[model samples]
Target: MTDKLLNHRAEGSTTAPPLLLGPSLGTSTVLWDTVAPELSATHRVVRWDLPGHGGSAADLIGPGATVGDLAVLVLALADALGIERFAYAGVSLGGAVGLHLAVHHPERVSALAAICSSAHFGGSQPWEKRAALVRREGLAGLAESANSRWFTPGFTVPELVADHRDADPGAYAACCDALAAFDLRDRLPDITVPTLLVAGREDPATPPAHLREIADAVPGSALVEIPGASHLAPAQCPQAVLIALRAHFSGGAKHGMEVRRQVLGDVHVDRAQARQTPFTARFQDFISRYAWGEIWTDPTLTRRERSMITLTALVAHGHYDELAMHVRAARRNGLTPEEIGAVLLQTAVYCGVPAANSAFATAQRVLAEEAEGTGG
Candidate 1:
């Protein structure tokens, strides 16, 4: 039954690329509450809660559990969702699970982002001690110090702290066991998938050096360090985490999204995004990656020049609706009304009079709308 799977929340269009999100040891899926919604605009985001932490059953894990064990559960979750392959990003313990998946189950992972995670976790002594303490004393005392260990001064997530407080003691201790024996340093060089390592500079637990170590060991990996952030960077610096995730997961699409906003304007881009459906997700990605990222971003031509070329092409092809949209883009690109008219007139000589006349009618309506601030 689905109840046997890890507790997870899925968002975005089903046809969109799948992206699995993992939470830190003590956190629930709510750790991604702020960032996952926006990422769902392009990805089918599925964020899961760790065993004994959120909605998952405590018995899902035990004292001798390893990160690999957690990873297996993740694969089971993906299997239950009918996801054969997916991209992954995780924080802390979650990040370790992502790395395990990438290394041990490369065929299942398309890309990876390990945030505030490490290859060795500074050996197992400290985690062993912590686990022992949790086992003997329960989570009340440990949860009290969670904010200090997980966040920078003056910043905290009460929900996450409560999660720590409410977590099943045995499962939480078992997770500590997982962290205790975890060591991927030797396997770092084996990760061939695209990898991104993020570090919170102020994090005393798993600092920037830990992430840097993974970056150095992993071939062709990238690293980003966020200041003013601690172990839970996504919770404290969600926008920063979001930017890094977007860049890492969809390089061209990320840059293309920015260009799309600039060329088409926010209102227009937002409208297009709003109208995007499961059937249209792939097309939207193509427009962003190929149209905006590659072509429009080419340095060989300026925005103004590109706008002029686009107008001519639309007119030549008799794409009146697109011509109308580009007419507004031309204005935004710094083309004066007279300059646009001149371009349209030139199109008539090559594209024939009928097409140009129709283009003119469309452009006139767009120009009139722009004048009244009624449309783009």
Candidate 2:
């Protein structure tokens, strides 16, 4: 693998799963600075600069390099880092690299988030003209225009513009050539990894419509449009982009199962599975698919928040049995006994004293049983 990639481990832990990041052509890994730190809390972030940008050498991109060729370099980088499988997020040309990897090397990708990118970057003539212009006059000829395309008004990052200016023109031209020949529309259906496509509503470079085409073609892929962003949505609107990436990477059926087990405990989940008869199998699947898969797996709220909400709702509805179950879940989600009591007490004001009283009784019994079992 080319030693061009930069790796940053999350500050608190080294055990998090790896996440590879790619930048748009002419930009360096610095393009991801806004979101990478937040993502690093849950992932070991590995970001790479395009050839000729940042630390990567211009000579590394040989003549006529294709997007597939860049995909190979990414896989090589992963292999070098001993990452057998990883989540990936990229922007523009970087997103194109992600598509190539997801399509051709499916086993290596755990999940994918493509921002302001397309399966096909439209007709080749524009790319050809850009490549020719860069080759003749260098990136200086196109830097201002390219920077303008990347962000909506008042959202530009000076560093990102500098990245474009610093890039080797020959390498940038080669990337343009790559974009010219890249087309993977037919291969979208073959991707099985959970995928997210983010588009900027104002992006003149790769508009929301471009991402919509890929989303429709890729089975189960989700598309999101950031309202006022342009090409560099991740940089311009980091919070929105981070939310989408976090959900895509960490919210899914498998993740839902993990969250379910964590909330309900392994014993409860195993017992529920064991009690499933053919007649009840569909019910179990429904809970797993909808309740856990759809609701519990939402990344917008933490498990603790959901637990508190669930407990309150159950008490308000006078669902004592469910309230009892969720009382145990609330404890598992790190809710303290005092906090549980507070939720029950609050229910009295909104849901009536009788409902809170019954909920209190049920929760007290469950909490006692839990305390006794653990000798706490």
Judge candidate 2 at residue 193 and give its lDDT.
93
lDDT of 1 by residue, 74-120 (tens): 99999999999999999999999999999999999999999998887
Error of 2 at 197 (Å): 0.7
Per-residue lDDT of model 2, residues 259-335, tens digit only: 77988888888988899998996577557645897688768999889988998899888899888889899888899
TM-score of each: 0.74, 0.70
Q: Which residue segments of model 1 deviate by more than 4 Å?
A: 1-3, 254-358, 361-376
lDDT of 1 at 70: 93
lDDT of 2 at 284: 70
Task: Record all residue pairs in model 2 with backbone atoms less than 3 Å apart, i.e. clashing.
Answer: none
Residue 134 displacement (Å), model 2? 0.8
Regions of model 2 farther than 4 Å from truth: 1-12, 252-376
Pairs of colliding residues, candidate 1: none
